[model samples]
Target: MTTMPAPRRLLTIAVLLALTGLVATGCVRFPAPESPPPTATAGPPVLPGVQVDVPVEPLPSSEACNATLTLRPPAQMPLPRQMPPNSTMAGILERGRLIVGLDIGSNLFSFRDPITGDIQGFDVDIAHEIAGAIFGDDRRVEFQVLSSAQRIDALRDMTVDVVIKTMSITCDRLRDISFSAPYYVASQRILSFRNSNVTGPAQLADKRVCAARGTTSIGRIQAIQPRATIVSTTTWADCLVLMQQGQIDAATTDDAILAGLAAQDPWLRVVGPSLGEEFYGVGIPKGQDDMIRFVNGVLERIRATGRWQEIRDRWLSILDSGYGAPQPYYRD
Candidate 1:
């Protein structure tokens, strides 16, 4: 969605041009040898390469949407490697692997294990469950890392069979893609340094707030505090880096994701009341209803077998006990 109005977009570009001229002319310079190039934004300080999304398709609204609902699971799950003929799972079986899309920078949801050089997290475990269901071997899945902005397009293009990222299901997104039953319910919140005066949403006026580009979080901030400067990054991890460097006042996103960011830095903490709830679900390509039902079947199995709790305890135990696996709901 367009992050800024037309007038503001032009002004920002002009400001950037003017700043480049100043740096080129040696009229002004950063105090340190390695500082981010000057940004034209009046809201938050942005690092080089971190960006502001120009106007695009207006973000879709979640009005009259119950993101928690998804296609019902099959009456009986087929044995692994025994996908129903002509079903989406059967196609995946023919391909010999399940392809998944997710970002590795999302900490507890998904991230690389520096020690093992492999991706692992709550989401990874869930992805494995789906793959294992189809191939009888979780490793039969091919993992593809994606930025937040790329999740839907990746699914639409069939680059991945499904996306197990920290994606929230919404009515607008459903227009282009399908989602599995809600697996996790997250709340939108803010993350700021512990000692910062910007303790909550009320204090966000004119302060620079950072969130991943093209996410619902950015739009919420834009509506909550019109004066707050919203900086868009490619991922929430980028927001964490900018916050650590004092480049931005605060970062906003789902609380579960924020908790991951907080664990990396002692100074960071989730603050203020939650903006709203985010219902996490698997992303499947639009019209892939069989795949949707199959993924829902896997999720249902996980929840019933207590594996859902196991994954949560393994990866998200650090979050306050209030957050837990969401109950599944079906559209049919």
Candidate 2:
């Protein structure tokens, strides 16, 4: 080999050593970490351009039940007003109309008259009572059919003066609106095909349950059976129709509502112990203390004069003697 300068030879040896060290150290890059595989228990999985929040535990019916179970109002609860001290009642009278938001699909609470095409039920009677108190005639009231999701928004937007759609009183709802004393007490129940093997909430695991969207029943079902699939419909009647068609394994809702459905279809039956109690109340826009008090007064008078009992008997006798008994709501 030809002789090289000492400095050039040393530089060449240094470059070769550096290259050897890099190779020995394994500096070559490797691949990135792999993402977790999709899981079956994962709820409503994420896909392209979509996101979902995990469903919450089913709400306890007991929360609403305990809130209204007592005859006395909470210490922090506001006292009922005697009457509107000014012209509010007079203004309602001048309008000659008492508009109320109600559920026409809920059988005993509010439903259509097959012959006259008019609304009728215990809730409808309550609306009529309020109208009669404001005007001298109960027939002055006009009914607007509302879905569960539409009830609160309709009241807030003044689309209706009040909501008597078998609405349950709850702290979450109190943040948005005021409620009258509970006019009816109901318990939550599960409905299934007449021969379903599912006995209770414990048995609902992996089952497909149906409920009306925006109703408390959906929350209750999810809470009890986190793994169960839920199918939501716009109305309880629609849920029942789906159940009849064998599209869903079960439906969860108030006992009164299930009772109505069972009455209509012998192929279905309600099962399990009552999930929880619920108290139905009228919803009004918050801060309308005068209107709330006026309603309380009307409710009190009706309870005292046997009119409330008569209305309940006329509509709810199908629920049995236990339901026929008078259970007066708390009124100042």
Candidate 3:
């Protein structure tokens, strides 16, 4: 079976460049301060020797909950072939392109295809579907790379019209933003070196486990084993780096992400049953019912037209798990 490969050596070089006053494309790095940076106004202090001027905001996520609880029904709307005048769809049309926020380091979900140098993956296709629905062209999109911590803030601040990243739908997040119907289902899992004795998350007790910042996987790891020291990085690629270097015993996150990481290193393997479920949704600003409805319409078309399965087969079905379209749930 063909496996997806994220260039680990290139990624390591990018990290090194970031530390040495250069940041490669698609990777995020904080600036180094000549002197001790000012005191943090919020969240935790910067890790020793890591100079980050940005404040890390706290975003709460569910621990082990399934996604069925917060599923909201999408509104009925015409196919997005043309803009509905005076509506959110119309506003997006007037702007000439769909603005989407996502992470470029998540291998299978969204990442730069090393050979083509264009960001492409399952999430990228989802964005393309939305763009195609609106402008009759899937290429009419501007992808803004963002870190995991910036997902909600990007939506709330309207920096991105929609967020197609692998974001989970939760009641906690609903308070701040709206979500489309669940498009993909993901479950938390553990990734470790192939020869490691670790069989599952439970075995990682008292060991180090890594997850992306502002993600639910971290909380799930804590619930699985409180003694396990949790490590947070800016991206999943970073987690894979820590695992490669033996800095952490295991990396835990959605199986979708772990598969991509394992593809990069044949020596890595994912162990254990699912920790819990995650239902992915496209995030829209709070109160933007039209935008939510529009996004759902796009998802509905993808599911019904077999496009969803096609995308999965192309990018994700290579993983050990098979693919099936998620049933759309409407709260109304």
Give the least accurate 10-residue stretch of model 1, judged by summed lDDT.
53-62
lDDT of each: 0.85, 0.74, 0.80
Candidate 3, clashing residue pairs?
73-330, 73-331
Higher-lDDT candidate of 1 and 2: 1
Clashes of each: 0, 1, 2
TM-score result, candidate 1: 0.83
List TM-scores for all candidates, in order: 0.83, 0.74, 0.79
Q: Compared with the true structure, what per-residue lDDT tens digits does model 3 show for residues 1-332?
A: 97446697678878887766633353555688789878867643333222122223243354334433333434555555567778887888889999999999899899998898999999999999989888888899999999888999998899999998899887677778888888888888899888888998768987878788877777667766777777788889887777776677888888899999999999999889888878788888988887777777777778888999999988887578844888875655
lDDT at 260, model 1: 94
Model 1 residue runs over 4 Å out of place are: 1-48, 52-63
Off by over 4 Å in 3: 1-81
Over 1-332, each residue of candidate 2 has an lDDT whose tens digit, in order, gives: 99999999999999999889888998756799999987756333222211122256448443643444323323332222222346445556667788899887787788887899888887899998888777667899878888888888888887888899878877677667778777777878888887889878887888878776667877777776787788776677777777776667888888888888787798888888887767788888777666766776677778778898898778777764334323544534
lDDT of 1 at 20: 96
Candidate 3: TM-score?
A: 0.79
